[model samples]
Target chain A: MIKLQLPLTEADVRQLKVGDEVALSGIMVTGRDEAHTWLINDKPDNVRKLLEGSVIYHCGPVVSKTDGEWKFVAAGPTTSIREEPIQADVVKEYKLRGVIGKGGMGPKTLAGLKEFGAVYLHAIGGAATLLAKSVKKVTDVIKLEEFGVPEAMWILEVEDFPAVVTMDSHGNSLHTKIKADSDKIAKELIGN
Target chain B: MAFKLNKEKFRDAVLELIRLTSTELPRDVIAAMEKARDNEEPGSAAKSVLGSMLKNVVMAKADSTPICQDTGTNIHFVTIPEGISLRKVEQAIIEATQQATAEAYLRPNAVDSLTGKNTGDNTGVMAPYIHFEEWDDPAIKLQLALKGGGCENVSTQYKLPDTSLKAGRNLEGVYKCIIDAINKAQGLGCAPGVIGVGVGGDRATGMIMAKKQLFRKMGDSNPVQQLDDLEQKLLVDLNKLGIGPLGFGGKTTVLGVKIGAVHRLPASFFVSIAYMCWADRHHEMLFTESEVSYD
Candidate 1:
C-alpha cells in the first residue's frame, strides 16, 4: 500500500491512479453537509491555507472527551455523492490535492479532480471502529454549537488511515465504470 | 389482579439492548462476511474490505464502541401481552434511548426538519420509531435494528408493470425490480449487503413488510417454497454484477435476499425493498418470569 502524508504535492497526487490502495498518515479535515454549504457560501479565508494540498473527508465521527482532551470513538466515511454540488468548487478553490470519501462523487467532481491535479479516495464504508484506530489525535474542531456534532469540521492528526483511490487525476472513476457494467448485466439478467 | 410493568427495569434493559445492538455484529452476518471473504481472490479489494469489516466488528465489541459512525436510526418492534400498556413501553423506550445517546450507544440522530437542529438527546417525533403487536404469550419481546443512513437512502419502492423494464405484476416482476434496486445501489448501500423485498401490499404496507423481513436471521429460510427459491436465485444473480464491497468490484455482492408478501387491492402492485449494509446490527430481547434473555 502507498503511504501518503498530508499536504501532498500536485505531482504526488497525479502519480496515483484508480485502484491503488493507500495508507494516509498526517493531517486531515472532516466535513459533511452543513460544513460543505458553509465553505462555498461563506468563502471563509481561514481554512484556505489548511485545505491547500490537503484532503477533506466526508465523515461524521463519534467523538468523546477525557481529561479535557477529545478523541474519536467511531469515524467512518459517509456517502460522498451528497457533496457533489459543492465538491468541485471545494477542490478547485482550496487547491486540494486529494478528497477522501466513500461511494464516490459525480461528473463535476471528476472534472474538478482532473483540472486541479487531485484524486478521490474511497474509504471503506461501514468500517468505523477499525478505521478510527488510525486517527492519532484530534487537533481541533469548529462549528460544534451551530451545526451539532455530526456536521462540525473536525481537524485531525492521523496515522496510516486506509483508503483506495477509486477516482484518479486521470479521470477514471470506478463508480461510473461499475455502474455502467452492473446496469448492462442487470438488463441482461432481467431479459426483456 | 392487574399486571404492573416495572418501568425502571424495562428502561434499563432497553439501554443494555441498545448498547449491544450498536456495538456487536450479529453472528450470522459475520459468518456470511467470512464466507464472502474466503470466496474472493486474494489481494482483491473485495477481500480487503470484508477483512476490515470483520476486524472492525471484533474491535467494536472489545472496546464497546459503535460498529459504525452513523449509528443509524433506532427501530423498535415491540410485542406485548394484552394487558400491557403501549404508553408505558414507549415511555420506557424513550428514556432508554436518551440514556443510550448519553452513554454513546447511539449518536443523536434526530434533527428538526426546518431548523436543522440536532435534538442532542436522540428523542423527538418518530425518534426510536416503535411498532406494536399483540401476542398471547405472557413474555414481552423487543427487537432493535440499527440502520445506517447510506443504506436507508438506497431502500426504495416500485410500482409494477413498469413499462420501461417490461416488468409485470408477478414474482418475475418482483425479481426484476429487486435486481434493478441492487444494481442502482452499486456500492452506495455498502454492497455485500442484505436485500429485503416485500410484495403485494399498498406502498406503505409493502415497505413495512420489507423492513420486517430484515429481523429474520440471515440463515433462516422462508417457509414458502416459491419465495425461498426466488431468494436463492436472486442471491446468485446479484453476486454476478460484481459490485463487490463498496463497488470496488469482485465477488460476494450480497449476503442474502429475503422477500415477504402481503395481500393488496386488485388495482395496486407495489414492491418495496429495504437495503441493509454489511454492518447489520439487529438483536432481540425477551422478558418473562421476571428475567430477561437476549439474542
Candidate 2:
C-alpha cells in the first residue's frame, strides 16, 4: 500500500530496498531486446540525456493509429533476464535510477543497482493490456520506422504505475531468494 | 484437385482471433489464477501478487489490449485438406501476422537468432514456421499461439534409453522429469503455469507434439486414461512444490498438465516438456468451404 512517484532521483532510488511496494508516477521510457542492443552496441547519441533521472520500462506495446493519432492498446513488461548482460552497463552509462520489468534481472544488474543508485521494479508479467492504462500519453517516439513498435524507444508519461522492488541499490534480489528456497525444496524431493 | 481459400477472409479471421485471445484471458486460466490466489494460505504476499494478476487480466480485457507487453512471437500449426492449395494459406498467415501484429500493436519480438537483427514485421525466413499436415478432411484448421520467450526458454527434452525404465514410461518418471524442469527453471519461465508433455516419439517429433499440445483448451483431460490419470497426479504434485504464483511461494504452481503421445519403437523414449506461462495466449479456428466462397 506504499505510494511513490517515478523519475526517481539518485537519493530516492538509493533509499528503497528489495520487497518495497511502489506505485510509480512520471515519464518512463519503453525499451526491449532490440532497443537494449542498440543502446549498448550502437551507443545511440543523447540516449543518456533522454534517460537521465528517468525510469526505463522493459516492454513493447501493442499500438494502433486512429485518425493520425497513435494510441496504445496493450503494453506489458518483458522478462528482464534477457537483458542481464547489458542491463548494468545500460544503467551506469545512462545514469538511470529505475527499471521496470517482469521476472527479475541477474547478478550483474543487481550489482549495478548497488554500485549505482538504481532500483529494479517488477510489473505483473502477462498483464500487458491492463498495464497500458497507466500510460497517460506518448510524448514522442524514436526509431519507429526502422525498429518498428516493439523495438522502438517509446517515451511515455505514466501515472501511478504499480511495481514491486524486486531488486534494490543494496544488491538484494527477491528472485535470488526465491530460487534458493525453491532449489532446496527441489533437492530434498530428489533425495539428494 | 485445388482447394481455394479467400486470402482476405482468412487473414481477417486470424486477426480477429488474435485480438480476441489477447484481450480475453481464457476462462480456465482465470479460474486457475483465482484459485491460486485464494489457496495461497502461507502468506498474504503471494496472495496479493495473484490478486494483482487477476485484476490485471480483467483490466486488459476491459481495455481491449494485450495483457502482457511481450505480445510474443507468433507460432502456428495448419492442417489443410489434401487438395487445398497451401500457397494461399501460407501467404495469408504471413500477411495476417503482419497486419495483426501492427493492429494489435505487438512488440517486435522477432529477432535474427544469430545476428540479433530485429525483423520489424515479426516474420523472416522460416520465422513463422508453418507445420502443414495434409489431412483427409475437407476443412482447414489453424492453431495460433503467441510463444513468449519467458515460457519458451523453460522447454526441456530428455532422451531416455529404452532399457532404463523398468515400468515402460511410468507416471513416476514423467512426474520426476517435470519437477526437475520446474526446479531448474525456477521463476525463470514465469511459473505457476501449464506444462505440455509429449512422450514416446523421436526428439523433433516429441518437441513439436509438445508445442502443439498446448493449443488444447485448459482443463480438458487427455483422451488416454493412463495419461489422463498421470496428468491429474502431476498437476497435484506440481502445485505442492509451492512455486506459487510467479514463484513467490504458495499453492497452485501449475494450472494444468497436458500430454500428447505417439507410438515409438522399443529402443528409445523421448520426453519433451514445454511450459506455457499464465499468459498462455492461443486460439483455434476451423475454416470450411461452406463458411465462405473462395475465388
Candidate 3:
C-alpha cells in the first residue's frame, strides 16, 4: 500500500494504478451534492484554493460539536455517480489530484482523470465509524447552517485514511470491468 | 406473545431500540460477514474492507455511535393487538425519533424536497415512517430498520417479461430481474448487501412485501418451499458475481437474499427489490405492560 500526503503532486497521482491500496494523510474536504453545485456554479476562489492538489470526498458525515470543537461521529463515502456531470469540471477547475468516493464515476470523469493527473479512490462504503477514527479533526466547515451537517463542506484533517485506487490516471477503471463482468454473468445467470 | 404495552415506557423503549439498532448490527449479519471474510483470499482488498467494516461494527457498538453516518431512514413496522390506540403510539414514536436525533442515534435525514433544507430533527411529514399491522397477539411488536440512502438509491422495481433480458413473468423472469438489478447496482448500493425481493404483487404491495422481508432474520427460510428455494438460489448466484464488499470485486456480494410473493392482478406484474447494505441495521423490540425485550 502506498501512503500519499495531501497537496499531492501530479507525479503522486500518476504513479497510482488500478487496484493499488492507499492510505491518504493530510487534509481533505468533504463535499457532496450541495458543495459540488456551489463549486461549479460559483467557482469560488476561497474553496478552490483549498482543492488544489487535494481530494474531494463524497461523504455526508454525522458530526457533533463539543466545546467548540467539531468531531466526526460517523463518516463514510456516499455514492459518486450522481456527480458525474460535474466531476470533470470540478477536477479541471480545482486542479484536484484525487476523488474519494464509493461507486466509481462515469467515463466523463475517467476521461477527466486521465487528462488531468488524478485518480478515483474507493473508500469502504458504510464503514463510517472505522473511517472516522482516521479523521484527526474538523479544521473548518463551509455552509454548515445553510446546507446542514451532512451537506456542509467539512474541512477535515486526517491520518492514514484508507482507500483503494479503483480508477487510475491512465483511464483504467475497476468499476468498468466489474460492471461489464457482472452484466454478462447476470445474463448467463438468468439462464443459469 | 399476549401482553400489554406499558404506554408510559413505550417511548423510552423505542429510543432504546433506535440506539441499539443504530450502533449494533444483529449477530447473524456479523456472522455472514465473518464467513465472507474467511472465504476471501487472504490480504485481498475484499478481506481488508470486510475487516474494517467488522471493526467499525464492533467500535460503533462499544462507543454507542451510528454504524454508518447516513443512517438512512427510520422505518418501523409495528404490529399490535386490537383496541390499541395507534395514534398514541405514533405520537410516542415521533417523540422517540426526536430524542434519537438529539442523541445522535440517527442523522437528520428528512429533507424538504421543495426547499432543499434539512428538517434537523429527523421529523417531517411521515418521517420515521411507520407501517402498522394488526395481529391477534396482544403484545406490541416493533421492528426497526435503518436503511442508508446509498443502498436506497439502488433499490429498484421491474415490470417483467423484460424483453431486453428475454425474461418472462415467471420465476425465471424474477431471477432475471433480480440478477439484472444487482448488476446495475454493482457496488453503488454498497456491495455485500442484503436483497429483499417482492414478486407477483401490485406496485405498492410488492414494495411493501419486499421491505417487510428484510425484517426476517438473516438465515430464516420463507414458509413456502418455492420462495425458499428461490431465496437460496439467488443468494448463491448473487455472490458469484463477485461484487464483493463495496463493489470491490470479491466472492461475497450479498449477505442475504430474501424473496416474498403475493398475488398480483393480471394487468400488472411488478417485482420490487429493497436492497439493504451490509450494515443491515434492523432489530425487533417486544413490549409488554411491564418490560421490553429486544432481538
Candidate 4:
C-alpha cells in the first residue's frame, strides 16, 4: 500500500524494498525490444536527457489515433527478461530511477539496480486495458512510424499506476526468491 | 470449388476476436486461478496476488479492454477441405490481418530478424505462415491463436533416442526436458500457464502441432483417453513445482496440459512443447456459406 510518485529520485528509490505494493504517479517512458536495441547499440542522442530520473516501462501498447489525438486501447506490461542483457546499462546511462514491466529481470539487472540506486517494478501482467487508463497524456513518440505503433517510444504522463517492487537496489529480487523456492519444492516432489 | 469470403467481414471478425480475447480471461483460466488461490498453502501473500489477478480479469471484461498489454503475434491455423481452392481464402486472411492490425491498433510485433527492421504491418513474407492441412471433411476450421513472445520463447523441442529401457519408452526423458525448459525460463514465460505437448512426429510437424494445440479451449480433454490421462498427470506434476501465478510461488502453476500426438516413423521420436501465457487469446470458428460464424 505504498504510494509512489514516479520520475523517482535516487533517495526515494533507495527506500523501496522487494514485495512492496506501490501506486505510482508521474511521467514514464515506454520502450520495447526496438528502442532497447537502439539504446544499447547507438546510444541515441538526447535519450539520456529524455529519460533521466524517469521510469521506463517495458511495453508496446495498442493505441488508436482519432482526430489527431492518440488514445490508449491496451497498454499491458511486456516481459522484462527480453531487456535483461541491456537493462542495467540503460538504467546507468540514462540515470533512470525505476523500470516498470511484467515478470522480472535477471541477476544483471538486479545488480545494476543495486549499483545505480534504482528499482524494478512489476505491473500486473494481464491487466492491459485497465493499465491504459492510468496513462493521462502522451507527451511524445519516436522511432516507430515504420514499425507501427508498438515499437514506438511513447512518452506518457501517468497517474496512480500500480506496481510491485520485484527488485531493489539492495540486490534482492523477488523472481529469484520465488524460483529457488519453487525449484526446491519441485525437486522434492520429483524425489530428486 | 473456390469460396470467396468477404474481406471486410473477415477483418471485422479478427478484430472482434482480438478485442474479446484481450479483455477477458477465458472461463477455464479463471477457474484454474480461483482454485489455485484457494488451494495455495504458502501464505496470504500468494493468495492475495491470485485474488487480484482474478479481480483484474473481471475488470478487464467489464470494461471490454485488453487483459494484458502484449496482444501477441496473431497466429491463424486454417484447415481447408480437399478440392476447395484456397487462393481466395488465403488472400482474404492476409487482407483481413492487415485491416485488423490497423483497426485494433495492435502493436506491430513483426520485425526483420537480421536487419532489425520492424514491419509496420503485422504481416510480411510468410509472416503468418499458414500451413494448409487437407482434411476429408467438407467444412474448413480456422483456429486463431495470439501467442506472446514470453511463452513462445520458452517453447522447446527434443529429439529422443530410439533405445527403450525397462521402464517403457523413457517418457520421463521428455518430461525432464520440458521441466528444464520451464526452469530456465523462470518466470519469463508467465507461469500459471498451459503447456502444449506434441509427441511422435517429425521435427516440423511436432513444432507446428505444439503451436496449433494451444488453440484448443482450456479445460477441454483430449479426444483420446490415454492422452487425456497423461494431460492430467502432467498438470498435477507441474503444479506440484510451486511455480504459481506469475511464478510468484503457489499451488497452481499450469492451468492445463494439452497433448496432440501424431504417429511418426519407428526410428524417431520427436517431442515439442509450446507454452502459452495467461493472456491466451484464441478462438475456433467453422466457416460456411449459410451463416457467417464466430466463436
Cα lDDT computed for each candidate against the true fold = 0.91, 0.77, 0.91, 0.76
DockQ values for all predictions?
0.84, 0.50, 0.74, 0.55
Lowest summed lDDT window (length 10), candidate 1 chain B: B1-10
Per-residue error at B105 for model 3, in Å? 1.2
Per-residue lDDT tens digits of candidate 3, residues A135-189? 9989999999999989899999999999999999998999999888887887678
State the lDDT of candidate 3 residue by residue for B149-245, as single tens digits.
9999999999987888788888888888998898889999988999999997888899889999998888898899988998998899988897778
lDDT of 1 at B103: 80
> TM-score of the candidate numbered 2?
0.89
lDDT of 1 by residue, A32-134 (tens): 9999999999999989888888899999988887899888999999999999998999888888888888899999999999998999999989888988999
lDDT of 3 at A113: 98
What's model 1's TM-score?
A: 0.98
lDDT of 2 at B173: 64
What DockQ score does model 3 reach against the true complex? 0.74
Candidate 2 chain B TM? Answer: 0.89
Residue A42 in model 4: lDDT? 85
Ranking by TM-score: 1, 3, 4, 2
